[model samples]
Target: MRPSDRVTLEDVARAAGVSRATASRVVRGDTGVTAKKTKAVQAAVASLGYIPNSAARALVSRRTGTVAVVIPEPDQMIFSDPFLTQTVQEISRDLDEADIQLVMVFGDQSGHGRRAAKYLRNGSVDGAIVISHHRFSGQVEAIMSVQIPVVFIGRPVAQASPNSWVDLDNVSAGRLAAERLLECGARRPAIITGSLDMVAAHDRLRGFREVLGRVGIDPVLLEGAFTAESGRAAGEALAPRIESGEIDGVFASSDLMALAALEAWRDRGLRVPDDVRLVSCDNGPEAAAANPPLTSVDNPTDILGRAATDMLRAILDETWDGQPVLVPARLLVRQSC
Candidate 1:
């Protein structure tokens, strides 16, 4: 074919010795095509330099071959948290494997949520994966109001969730942290938790409290923003209690917070596991970098990301049966405990 001439699907079908429908099905990634015919179609596409015009294909398929990754958090929070970065990267890679484009949107802050909701409602993408949405943010309400297929990366914070979601077993993770603290002989334990607006945070705190109560330990609770600074503040608040022998163990809901607590203890000349044992969630690099290496719970953010992407794909494919995916978490013991 001349450089000025466009190679159409029918041209490729003729070159591959297959019908146009068979070629179209292969290009659309539909299954049930024989391996020999599929190979021929691919070879013909390569030789003919055939390109599927996405705009034309969308007209017939009603799919844009694009999806939105909506992060309902401030830009600073997204950049500061490694879990968020890891999850986004995984989701992007998974979507890439499916030959789909990712359109990222920061939904929190100012009128971002409203604009994103409007864009999605306009059928700009086939579906969306919303992450870290809060109940009061009005973002979840906006997304749910749209007609697009949606999947959440965390437990939906809205009162009435209409879509499937993928989340870690946060309650179980909290219990695991609690058990690790107790096993290390931490009698008076305190918990530093993430924001309560998030269902994940609430579930983690609830699980931690339940397990501590079973052992007759009334844990001290501290609200944290899942930031290093918040962890430092919580640590400073507990310093006096640590000296008074009122608090001997700590469970920071996030690895960053746990590391901050470690630094705070170090500043007070307290030895880890000797004076206070600590455990946290999210087995991130910060956990491994602690002076004594903090023992932490594995949050499995990567798995959650892939699961969310898969769920969204299923929804768009019309094969979803309205079931949510719940990934599990585990504990990683280290010297801090």
Candidate 2:
């Protein structure tokens, strides 16, 4: 092959003294090809430096072998949020095992949503898995219009309804967190929630409120943007009340925020659990590492990722009838609550 030129499958087939079909079968690991012929094709493929064109293979197979994972969070938040990172990690690992390529797209900021729409419309991928669709831009509308297979990571907003999705039992997670605190003899509980626009946050809060209300405790609620900064700010704002002994227990929607709340309490010279108990969601690494380890709701991101990939594969195979998959969440109790 020329130094600057790309090698083609035809060259490999010719070098191997085999038909292109035989070479393709060997490359795809199909059983029909004889072992001797497979060895010859692989040797030729190596000698000619023949790299299969994924796009071309996709065209012939009617499979892109590419899945796009869209996160509608800003670039900074996408990197900082443990849940998003862990979920994507699991998705990538699962897709890698299936020899599928994973494409990551960030739709958190303003113009990126439009870019995501254009990319999906271009038909460069077989399907998409959407996460964190709190913002209601034209992006969700664009994704829905593409007429391709889509599996959402969480329950998408109303605009993207009638679409298949995989999500943890967020309501149960919330109730579990609340119950943990209440079982510990917590009377005055405060909540720091994610943006109310997001379904996960809404469901989590709803579950928590239901449990607390049944027990005759009016929970104090605060809204945070699912960031450590927002959590810290909420904590600082609530410190006065906390100091006054008005709030005895606290639950932040996410572990990242919950950790910040822990620090905020420390800054106010208050001890964890001893002075004020705390709990949060997304039982990620940070929760375990937090001082006076944080009790949290486990969302099982890895399981969710694998399930979403399976759903997309089913859709690709025409086996899915557009059904939603619900994964249950569990509670991880620690010293913080």
Q: Pick the candidate with the highest lDDT.
A: 1
- For 1-337, candidate 1 gives per-residue lDDT tens digits of 6789989999989999999999999988899999999999999999888899888989998998999999878788889888888888899999999999999888854663787788888878899998887767676778888888889988886668765998888999999989998899889999999988888889999999999898788899999988889999999899889888999999999988888877888899888888888898999887887788889889887789888888898888888888888778789999989
Report the alpha-carbon TM-score of model 1 versus the true structure: 0.94
Q: Give each model a TM-score.
A: 0.94, 0.84
Per residue, candidate 2 scores C-alpha lDDT tens digits across 232-283 of 9999988898889999999899998998988998988999999889999998
Where in model 2 is the C-alpha error above 4 Å?
A: 1-56, 108-112, 135-139
lDDT per model vs. reference: 0.87, 0.87
Q: The CA-based lDDT of model 1 is what? A: 0.87
TM-score of candidate 2 versus the correct structure, residues matched by position: 0.84
